[model samples]
Target: MADAPLNGIRIVELAGIGPGPFAGMMLADHGAEVIRIDRPGRGGITIDAKDPLLRSRRSVALDLKKPEAIAAVRRIVGQADGLIEGFRPGVTERLGLGPDVLLADNPRLVYGRMTGWGQTGPMAHEPGHDINYLAISGALHAFGRAGEKPTPPINMVADFGGGGMMLAFGMLAALLHVQRTGEGQVVDAAMTDGSALLMSMIWGFRGMGRWSDRRGENLLDTGAHFYDTFECRDGKWISLGAIEPQFYAEFRAVMGLDAPEWDRQMDPRSWGPLKAELERRFREKTRDEWVAAFAGHEVCFAPVLGFDDALADPHNRARGTFVEAGGVTQPAPAPRYSASATVAPTMAGERDDAGVLRDLGFAPQEIAALGH
Candidate 1:
């Protein structure tokens, strides 16, 4: 608790799906005070009692359709350092929690909004999910085999990267501004904006003719043999990433390709044949054998580990990369800092509303009035 980086920060989260919850979790995991306003009753999709993703935060169930509930939220917002919500453009406005209303009362509050298409674009009001968001951003087009439709990358690209990460970034940016200028502003975190921003390097590559827009045709897209996964004799997979020439040479040496034909490592025309040959060689050894063969070498190899296997990995276990909370195992705090490293807390339920109200400097009578 002493090292909690965000210990004094207060955040009110308007509960929603996917990215919103994730963003809240990130802030809470770093020791910020996050209170999620849940839908009254066990409505919609219910979180499992032991859901790790929902840990480290408190919940306050409120039926925002009622005036009393709206008043309660406005009260909480009055004292909050920030607020995070992931809803479509007009949803908050209809609920009477729009930026203008909140900012008028709390000029220093950071109002963070997370959305798929953003607040003003034509697609802002359209209904879409992760795959659709990525497709619009050209990210999905670059993920599959040559001449094949791109496969979705397990919702990581759009939801977490584009959504949650963007929200967190915007919140932090706004918070910084508020601290310096004594003013709060709304943070518009659009998934399209975030996902497209993430693709800047790839776009640069394409503009420079170093990368192809076609799927599976770029060096880092698994088009090159040196940067792909290969199956071993044991039916397990191993990833190879020897991008630099020196590393490629080390890979070739470990694979016993020390002769004339192996010298064409950079010849574009020879890559296909070389990759085929390497595949054949890789198939002759089990995954563990391949791992052993290059244990101390700079071949840049790692076994394709499943979720469970990743937890037990020596390197991961050594770093305490995973932890158990609420009877569920999940990822630990990240982007470590020596002075203010975040620590995960073990809790699965919302703190009592009255208790949190007191912590926010509200008297007992004000807390009781919130329920009325």
Candidate 2:
């Protein structure tokens, strides 16, 4: 951990849910000393100590409604490099820990704000979750079948991808700015904006007249026969992405798709029929059988693994893609570094409140006054 890129950085996290905790986890995984300020009592979507998102951070339970707690947060942030919060707009300002106050206390503090609608839009103060955010971002419209209602990708796109990950990136960018200029700024990371930004390539495709507004009618949205999932004989699934001509030819050659109609690889009218043929062909073999068939081929094939299968997958195991911590199996820290390797995750555990406060140079009397 000494060589970790964020080893010397400290972050104060005003814990809420979802993206805020995820950002803190990303920072903590990279060796930032992320101290999370949790509510004194559990409420909506509480993250238990063993939750992977809470890993590698020390939690301090403080009632932000209390004046002493607010002061304690200020004391902590005054010496920290960054702070993350996911409250609705104006909530932190009401609690007296807004960016203005914290940045005044520490001029180089990168204040990261996570929200679904951003800090200034008309819907900034509205209450919404991942689905609602994707709905507004136009990402949801591109997620379903050709004639089906758009399916949510189970919060992965907006919550973790756009919201939390983008906040982490913004925090690091702002932190870099702070290092260079001895100044800080607010990072308004809105899920809506981030999700829309994620669609840049698709927007470009649309602008180039290669994409349509219709759902699942584009090349990558499962509209093409070569780019969709298929059910196997055993009821398990497999996916294909044989978009390139060579790969598609390999797919057809391997699957015995020698009919004349199968040559129309890019014809929209032939996709539905080709997909039907693929469905029938795939159901002729079990998922494992198909996996074995495509093992050394370049058909862009993979089995759609479930959690247990994913954990036990040979490729995943070889790459150490998942690790066990605190008796729970979860994904490992990603984007591995050659020089600044990230720290292995540890479970969130009980902390000595007074010890933590003392490390922060808080006197015993002051700690007691804060009811720590």
Candidate 3:
């Protein structure tokens, strides 16, 4: 993709699980030449070539326990624009491939470090998954119903949204700074920080006294009758979000809710009974029937589609939101550009040790000595 936004950019990704690979995938999707350094005989969570996160990049397997392998990584990073690594704070330092060494080798290298707790905190070295990070960030407490346990959104919020996407943004920002100043810097992208940042709007609502600390007692958290999912007659679900007065009026008109009690749309006391009534009313029709009834209306309604249905959806199909690679269906690269078109994703392929080394300007003797 010669016209892609990141066409000339090159990223060296030290393989790890979760956010690290996702960041690499995002970069690679937009035409960054991302060289993934995988551990020898260990694939991490991206188990094989077909894994979506590993797509659109060439991989090189190297045993970091060996000093020669470390040298090889330095050699690769010397010519690269950036590097992404997800490890505990001091792990890379112990491996002799820390920011100091790599930045010394290449002054213009943007180094990105992804972690759950960040680089300097007391919990930085402690092991944690996305759930722990989200919990500590104060985002998880607002996730579930009012009286229920906080439901984890299955790692999507912290891991992919906050962690990986944040790292990608930081990497790109640092790379742009390198372009302008001829200087490189490290990006410490912490899931805790990122997840908290993702809740900025909620924090604003809290400060403005428009939000409740209770999970499901807020406007956008299914507290409103019009802003929640309802089960249909066929056992499927549909969601509604008619927040504005006009939209709520449209909802009432479309649904034929002529009851006088429905006038108290904002009265929280009426929410429970109204929601019960809505539940009963929605159950009178199938999901598809309701979808048809709400078609071409301004009620902000949509079916609660599962993955298979989402992939098959008409709108998603029109936008090419999902694509197939290596016979596996997955989401396409997002945030489409108007001028710089992105490259289509390709499945991860076999490691090309010598090929990658040669591309990094390694001599034949040095490549031989490193031993793939």
Ten-residue region with minimum lDDT total, candidate 1: 40-49
lDDT of 1 by residue, 316-357 (tens): 999999998766888887767777868575656534666666
- Please tell me which model should have the higher TM-score, number 1 or number 3: 3
* Clash number by candidate, in order: 1, 0, 0
lDDT of 3 by residue, 129-231 (tens): 9999999999999999878999889999999999999999999999889989999999999999999999999999999999989889778888889899999
- Candidate 2 all-Cα RMSD: 1.9
Off by over 4 Å in 3: 42-47
Q: Write the per-residue lDDT of candidate 2 for residues 1-372, one digit (tens) a residue.
A: 248889999999998789999999999989899998877655322358678999988777778889988999999999999999999999999999998899999999999999999999789989999999999999999999988999999999899999999999999999999989999999999999999999999999999999989998889999999999999999999999999999999998899888899899989889998899899999999999999999888999999999999999999999999999989899999878877888799887665566778888889999898777
TM-score of 3: 0.97
Model 3 C-alpha RMSD to native: 1.7
The residue-level lDDT of candidate 2 at 9 comes to 98
Q: Which stretches of candidate 1 lie over 4 Å from their true place?
A: 43-46, 361-372
Candidate 1 RMSD computed on C-alpha atoms after optimal superposition onto the true structure: 2.1
Model 2 residue runs over 4 Å out of place are: 42-47
* lDDT (Cα) of model 1: 0.84
Q: Per-candidate TM vs. native?
A: 0.94, 0.97, 0.97
